[model samples]
Target: MAVRPILIFPDRHLSQPARTVQYFGPKLDTLIQDLMDTLRSTPGVGLAAPQIGVMERVSVIDFSRMKKKLKPAPCQDVRVLINPILLSGSGIQVPREGCLSIPDLLANVRRYEEVRVRIQDQMGAELILTASGFEALALQHEMDHLDGKLFIDRVLNLKTDVFRRKT
Candidate 1:
């Protein structure tokens, strides 16, 4: 497994919808590992295949770091979602969000406070995940990438809702 380069904003791949993973093979395994490596190397909660220039329907998320800070951690798990599809969503939470692909910019992008998603895991087993709070937001954020969307795309106003992060 290797840490792949994360495609930045303006990269056409980031704007293009990824192809569904039709086969669970070595290539798929590599993609999953590479994504995990990239996420661990970078400062982010999740990563999608397209963000690494791979237009495949794959994403990796590790919420442990972000969860540990909370009084009751949401979940300490690393997840891989392949061909992810949102089954249902409810509520709304516009927590400030940022993306590794977008660098230092942070924005308030409204996301489902709770969501149920169906996706294939690293081993190709299909499962449904119901999550709320930060975990829900993270899932939605990564799922957006499969549809070629970014956190910035959902920001209502660049002047007010978006701002550069303090170094």
Candidate 2:
């Protein structure tokens, strides 16, 4: 497992839709492990394959620890989702979001307040989950990468919703 460098914004690879994982082999496992390591190293809640320059439909999320501190919900272990598919999410809410790819830029983007998602783990076991609030937002944000969408694409207003890097 290694920490892969996250691809920054404006990269062409980030704009292209990711390919699905055809085989759940050792290479996929290595990718998953690398993603987990990279996500944890950044101390981030979620990460997508495109972020690490892999054009595959893979993502890992660890909102358990963060959610526990922010809410009173029961927390679970870290979750790694590969080829995640968003099923549904009800009600839209604009949240201020930041991206590792975008660096210091932050923006307000519209997202669902809650969501239901289906995904497979690193071992190819299927799991479906319902998430709300920040967790929901994070999942939506990461999943967007599969379709080549970024927080910047969802920015409510470039003049106001998007912010510049702080030096």
- What is the lDDT of every predicted structure here? 0.87, 0.82
- Tens digits of per-residue lDDT, candidate 1, 53-165, equal 99999988887857433234444588888998999999988888889999889999998888899988777889888888788888899999999999999999989999898
After superposing candidate 1 on the true structure, give the runs of residues whose Cα lies further than 4 Å from its correct spot.
67-76
Query: Which segments of candidate 2 are over 4 A away from where they belong?
Result: 64-75, 165-167
Pairs in clash, predicted candidate 1:
none
Model 1, C-alpha of 28: deviation from truth (Å):
0.6
lDDT of 2 by residue, 1-167 (tens): 89999888898878889998778889998988998899888857888898888899998878764633433433255777777888998988787788778888888899998889988876788889888777778789988988899999987679989987676
Candidate 1 local Cα displacement, residue 141, angstroms: 0.6
How far is each candidate from the true structure, as Cα RMSD in Å? 1.7, 2.0
- For all predicted structures, in order, the TM-scores are 0.94, 0.90
Clashing pairs in 2: none
**Maximum-TM-score candidate:** 1
